[model samples]
Target: MKSGYNVAVVGATGNAGMVTLRILSEREFPLRDIVAIASTRTLGRVVSCGNRALKTQKISDINWSDIDLAFFCAGEGVSSKNAEIVADRGCIVIDKSSYFRQHPKVPLIIPEINLDTLEKGASYGIVSTPNCVVTPLVMTLKALSEVASLKRVVVSTYQSVSGAGRRAIDELYNQSKEIMTTRSSRPEVFSKQIAFNILPQVGNFYESGISEEEEKITCETRKILMADVKIAVTCVRVPVFIGHSMSVACEFSKALPTKNIRNIFEKIEGVIVIDRRGEESGYVATPIDVQGEDAVFVSRIRKDTSVKNGLLYWIACDNLRKGAALNSVQIAESMIKIDPSLSKFRKTYSRTKEA
Candidate 1:
């Protein structure tokens, strides 16, 4: 494999797939070629990558053997069936679905925290990106864990409709329009009314009383941080059309000052600390405000007066970009920067199965 490689953005017609193209162009990642791939129906669509226009192609008909790396932004089933085919042809597969994340051979990466895990999974034939919610929450906690030990965490997500894909965004818009016209709006994309109300469940409920979205945060956080940190998550669906936001309450091993914590977050990479002083001076980063931004916005920092070593704050990031596409692209960039042989060596001996 050469330093400059041919890369394919699978699912190029989807929301996350288009965002992947944007980040790759914005970062100016080195590439010998760029292939925008989607389903048969979307084959003729045009997507802008820098000044050049790339035509979408059918994933099934593409020659995966010519690709050096394939970014899977499509659904889990697509990734599950085709990721191995790409990998078998000597291409590194950086997947964005939950399908391969938990496999012992696959690494659920957050780039900022445990990129070392990537070196451990190259032998297994694939790499995995964590869920969008897990990315921002873990990115923020990575710095926090360094300052003081994190014992437990509680998160409530205010998720945007885009995370549910493009059709969901259209559903929200149509529903809102009907409500304004004083007409009946049927909920087709969601189980209940989402135009003006919030739903507590993001995914289906399991017998364990936790939704699948909540479980992703718990399991992925533990794997990426490599900690026994306990997490409780309540994923909520909101009317916002873009970005995902979370409110976090965390307990630490030692009491720390708010000023000191703020200072630390300011220096952490991939995080933008937007905090201020006083009652109304506090920081608040909403979905609409954070849209299209690469950095995770952190605000509303305050000490938990009840607990000896506790703190709370809000975090927001474009779920399509930083949450999925940006992070996957970052991992690929890391792989390219290192000796290509190292990726091969790491995969050859790295641990693929979990205990």
Candidate 2:
């Protein structure tokens, strides 16, 4: 694996895509080139990468083989179409979509838990990022998994509007403003009024009444962290623009002390343990505090009195960063570090104005 490498970011104009470039720049990913790719409509649009504005190239016509690593932050439609095209060119793809997540061959990765799975390079496959809700939940559960065998998990998410992308964020803002002035609002971006209320659904509900988003959280968590752990989840979309918060209760195979569980979380990388006392004393990781930051915050640890071997905790993180972009970029960084042949492409990505 190499220290620096050429990278591509699909859907560069979108929220997650923009944050991906920011993280790559902040971490200084070695890049000889950064192909800022988008659909034909968004081609020629510019995205800020550091002080320079990188032009968005239309992904439909690009030569995939020219890029060593392509980070697909586009929608499921684009991902299903070209993720394999990029992979077939021998370029590794770290996707931020649900497309290949359930695929038997494609590894659904949260770098903290499953980097070992990527060590063996079979085909140039896609490594899919878990849902925003799943990332924080699984990380929190990993510590608990070691202390007492995790048997079941029940979580309810308070997710931000940014999880729905820029349009939803704008809708919340505009609707709130309209209500303040006109005392009325209408549903558009979300199924109902999100300005002053919480929407219980994150995505279209399936015949089972659970959203695709909720199902992903349950299914991806089981796949990523505890394969046998039974999960029950409820997802809600809130008005906040960024970040996601989860209140989780877990039932374990054996009884354990809460203090011991907290200590294990303290040592996990990328997890901040904030268990304290009083009104401002507890571990309160707000989405605003975590926006643009790269760590999962865990607090409010206590025993769940209702169930045996049960404990309750709260977790929060910037969904776009830690949950999607940063997670995918870290996977790309991991892959390059592991593959010796890919090392030559690493270098600082510089954009120059076209003549």
Candidate 3:
């Protein structure tokens, strides 16, 4: 641990990568220097990091040995190839990718849920952040699972085009314009036209009809919860641009009081309950409201009447922030908290200032 660490943001020109830089600057992470690394195509571009503009360097050009911490927001392919290399160079890598998530050695972390896993697995040198859809789902479930033992969970996600990447976002906008002007559109980034349409399938489906996205939710929920709860998931691509939303139903061993359930969520650090069920508008959280926010907004909470011990709720969160960048930055912050050696000045400054 040094007084200030040199950090690098991989895939710096991508949406998640850019957000990671912004968060690091917004949070004022203790850093000596910050570097942005991207693919050759993005090299030389400038990415805004709070008040600064960081010029992007090619990933191949990065000197991994010089970086103390690296946030990897590059897609799975790039992460798979470079994560180990970065770690081997003695740099801590917090990766936002699916490639290493399921690995027995790699700890898939949602700081609020399983940060201890990171502290315990520090020797591994690499930590993984979950998929965008898995983030809010697991965060909401952890609270309920603690109050009542979870038996099963069912989730249907309404993911946004941005989850696919910037090109997908552009495709959605372009296709919507074409449809409005000419009554026809083309699909390229997505399997079908994403504009003005909701695709029930998110990722490729297997013989059992479970999509890759669905499988991720199922496995990830179980892992993060550290429970054997059975999970069923259906992931859909929606027309929204930034936030990811999910309708989740959970079955517990015993019925949980609705008031108690609300209390549990309200007490959780990163969750916000917007339940206004009895009001004139009886408003609920939606993607538009949660686009740039870090907190998981949960609403429409109630007991499932059909089941003996079940609860239902709707949740929305910024996929790029809490789902990816913010979570990665939080992991770095948690590392500093858990291992004081990682922060060169935080402990000393606190003690000296108090004195």
TM-score of each: 0.93, 0.92, 0.94
Q: What is the alpha-carbon lDDT for the whole of candidate 2?
A: 0.82
RMSD of 3: 6.2
| Segments of candidate 3 deviating more than 4 angstroms | 343-355
Residue 235 CA error for candidate 3 (Å)? 0.3
Among the numbered candidates, top TM-score falls to: 3
Global CA lDDT computed for model 1: 0.85
lDDT of 3 at 59: 77
Query: Which lDDT values do the candidates have, in the order given?
Result: 0.85, 0.82, 0.85
User: On residues 108-216, what C-alpha lDDT tens digit does candidate 3 reach at each position?
Assistant: 9988888777645225677889999888888888888778898888888899999988889899999989999998987988999899999998878999988888888
For model 3 the local lDDT of residue 218 reads: 82
**Decreasing TM-score order of the candidates:** 3, 1, 2
Q: Candidate 2, TM-score vs. the true structure?
A: 0.92
Alpha carbon deviation, residue 111, candidate 2 (Å) = 1.4
